[model samples]
Target chain A: MSVVSAEALRERPVEAVPEDAHDDGLAPRAKFLPSLGAVYRAQLSRARVARIPLLFVATFQSIGIMILMRGVVDQGGREAQAVVAGSAVLVVAFVALNLLAQYFGQLRAAGGLDHYATLPVPPASVVLGAAGAYASFTVPGTVVTAVVGCAMFDLPLTHLWVLAAVIPLAGAALSGLGAALGLLAPRPELATLLGQLGMSAALLLGVLPADRMPEFVQYARDLLPSTYGVEAFARTFGDHPDWATVLLDLGVCAGVGVASLAVATWAYRRAAVR
Target chain B: MCAVRGLSKTYPAARGRRGAPGTPAVRATDDVRLDIRRGEIFGLLGPNGAGKSTLVRQLTGLMRPDSGSVEILGHDIVRYPERAARILAYLGQESTALDELTVSLAAETTGRLRGLSLKDARAERDDVLEELGLTALAARPLKKLSGGQRRLACFAAALVGRRPLLVLDEPTTGMDPVARRAVWAAVDRRRAERGATVLLVTHNVIEAETVLDRVAVLDQGRVIACDSPAGLKERVAGEVRVELVWREKAPMELSEVARLRERAVESGRRWSLRLAPDEARSAVAAVTGGPAFDFLDDFTLATPSLEDVYLALGGSRSGVKGLVKA
Candidate 1:
């Protein structure tokens, strides 16, 4: 017996696939947007049962923080504005950053990347779809907290629509960071721990008033992407919001989102190969 | 429609905990070459650590080989790695991540990801579910099902929106006899109707011998034999494996036992001897005749199987060279 060479093996009259030899004619390569939508829907359905209760917990926790902070700050003052803004964005950080990290971490440790890699879908679609699904869970939580905080603090509701910008931008940045942490951690337990620590950082830094903080702590606050979301939402509570400053804060959030997501995509590709 | 030539991959050494030294690197696959024909059901067979799984990953472009090339459907998968998902539906042994999804959703979602239109994806998902006799279990989450049922669901997911090549590793593992037949029937129907080629990696030699058109037996990251089941069995032709079990006591000074024991492989109370057909008959008679029956629990004489070929080719050894091709 001998090893069969390519030409020698082709001596037989068999034909396997008869489609365009140069193309993936069996099924068209999945377009990015459509496939991303499909992944989002699937991930959303799969995660709904598990994340719904957590979403409630997240919303309730943010609301409780505002109630506690009201005792320490003057109503209708700048400190009150910081507390309300930080509490709202904290919802986004809780779901998008914390839960998303645990999800991808478990997926990686359990060899779930192999399943997605085998699919014809683009790798970016997988990361984005999951990020979108987890972030979507934060929408209602963030809104309910913001509305409740404004009422409790006697803040005007005229600029509540700014939440539209806050949730997605902050969610993207946090989701990307969460995803990267999960995929990079060698173990799922470590990923979960890291996610909890991240949510803690958002709580301690984002929800706290910056004026009383030590100078170094304020610098640390600036490093957290969710803090910028806090800043943007807090500025909107003024008598006349500075539109340019709000836009600048959002632009920074969006930039961090893209950079972090790119890092996550790179992490996913690296993990999938092994 | 799959071609692999001179593929090799070596893992880098792991750094030590103290950063002073490292564990040795592992060469998972050597310079391996194989060509699977169109519409063929090919099997990769080997003992544990023989690198069958690594080769399968490289062939599907999930893992990059250090050197060499892989082509599926005439496209260079080595250069355009993502093309593998288009050319083949890879069903790996690991399907735990899909455990959260219901059987129906898993199948339908896979079809959608394969670029099927929503309506077509649903229709095909339903068809595959029905064909696999899983319509009743379609709504059940995979984690709630039996291991065998989960494996069947994974198969259904892979089968939906068919690709030209199906790379299935251990597809029938954990399956009950009935489910295994259903899987093979579905695979056979696809091959006959749509001309799909199948590349299977399995440790189940009986299944391989029963269904595979060809097999490649690997040892130490290299293929030592590639041939049809019957062709490979010829490596141990004219030999019968006589297995004997003894009761509480051993046979004392039986001439046949003494002669066979010298060349026999023993595990616990059972002994397996490679013998000629006539020698096997004589040995069986000796073990069951007279007072020898008191010591003999049971015995069997069998023809050579694909497993014997694997053993003969040293599939469990450190390394084996020479390709026994068909």
Candidate 2:
């Protein structure tokens, strides 16, 4: 009864997956998107019950930062506009990314993946369902933060309708990144630390006026997914916004959202099987 | 019905604190093979680290085997995990409930995941909770439940949809006798009403002995034996145990008692003598009808049982300790 190590097994290449693996005749299999609505509803209810308070905190924290920035920046300028919009989008990142990291991390640490793993639902639905739920929590907070920040900075409130699009776009990018970090981290404590650090990084890079940053720091800001979202919303506050540039920024946000969420789904699949 | 062939899985060796690795790799499951027939309660019996959970995981498609094939109802599960999942329901070794969810919510969500409509899922969840006598605790959050209560809640969730195949890993762990019996009754009902196949993994051999139509005994990632409870007990047949107690004033010296140990395994007042099937009556008569018959307080004959076969098949303390080391 001597046991052989996995390393020994790894020396041999894996057997090719058989074509029969994809056969549907064995049992009545669920479609890839089957019960997505049910999954989404369950996740949303769980988030509403457990995460609403945190959403409020994220909103207040963003507004408080905007009020603080009002003292340094003059009213009705591009700097003020960036401060207002950046702080608002920052709320979405806070809950969607930071909180989600902790949620999935704790889920993995607690053996919660087994619950989803044995279910007939596709892996993508689990990731997307959770991410969508966490992202939804950002909407009320993001909207409240935007309105309060605009009032404090004396920016035009007329263009506030843009937040409807901005909240979801920013939420998708940040929530996906958050879910990936949580699922990938080996330890729950490490995931929490990474989540907090990620939020702080977003605050430092996304909230500050880009003109004042060093050339290299500005490049780092551009690398962040939330920066394009903030820039897209910030441009909308102007008298004559550049529709082309705004669409480009939002498109970048949407593209990064898809990529990050895809990675998160991949991470979930990897963690679940192990 | 399910069949597993050539199932094997190896996990990377864990490094010691000093950084030296013990085994190059640990075979969690080693060339194991098994078949679970329809409408039978099949038991996977083993000590800790004996690959019971590993085998269950492989069958459920939660983990892929390094080398093996799992076919459910003649469909290869490895190639068609989703299809396998459709007919099979798994209650893993770990509790699978979201702490934020209430007991009913968790059960309802599970039913929904199993493809019930919202209304039907809710109805099924309520029915299951009530059937399991957990209706009182249905509104409580999972985090607020005791360990046994949580286990029962998750067990109810698993039973909600009643798929054809049910694989439960240590389902009765940490449960009170009442709750344990409730789960057993539920399992029995599933088998009786639906002809559902149940593959149960458990350390409670005595409890399993009553329900298992067939069982496989695993040791150190290998299936050392597989048979019905009676069939396995029959393997160690012809052996009989006689329990006796001496009269308070009997003339048996310590040395004489030591000599008696040569033929019998003694425990306190009980002497388990190994007598052949034909010799049992005469041996009992000789011990109870001889000169010491008047000095004997009591005597009884005990037949060989599955527990005896289990221990005789190297499922002793040291054997399990070796498995733990691996």
In order, the first chain's TM-score in every candidate is 0.91, 0.88
User: Model 1, range B1-326, lDDT digits (tens) per residue?
Assistant: 77889999998898888767777888888999999998899999876678988999888778999998998878888797787888889898888667778899889888888888889889999999998899999999888899999999999999987788899998987888889888888887677656888999987777888899999988778988999999999979989888888886466586756776786767678887778889888878877876677888888889988767776776663221122211
Candidate 1: residue B100 lDDT (0-100)? 78
Model 2 segments more than 4 A misplaced: A1-27, A31-34, A186-190, B15-24, B237-305, B319-326
Report how far residue A188 has shifted in candidate 1, in Å: 3.5
lDDT of 1 at B45: 86
lDDT of 2 by residue, A64-151 (tens): 8987888899988999989888898888888888998998898898878887788777878888888888888788888888888887
Q: What is the TM-score of each candidate against the true structure?
A: 0.90, 0.83
Q: Give the CAPRI class of candidate 2.
A: incorrect
Off by over 4 Å in 1: A1-27, B15-23, B249-259, B290-292, B317-326
Model 2 reaches what TM-score against the true structure?
0.83
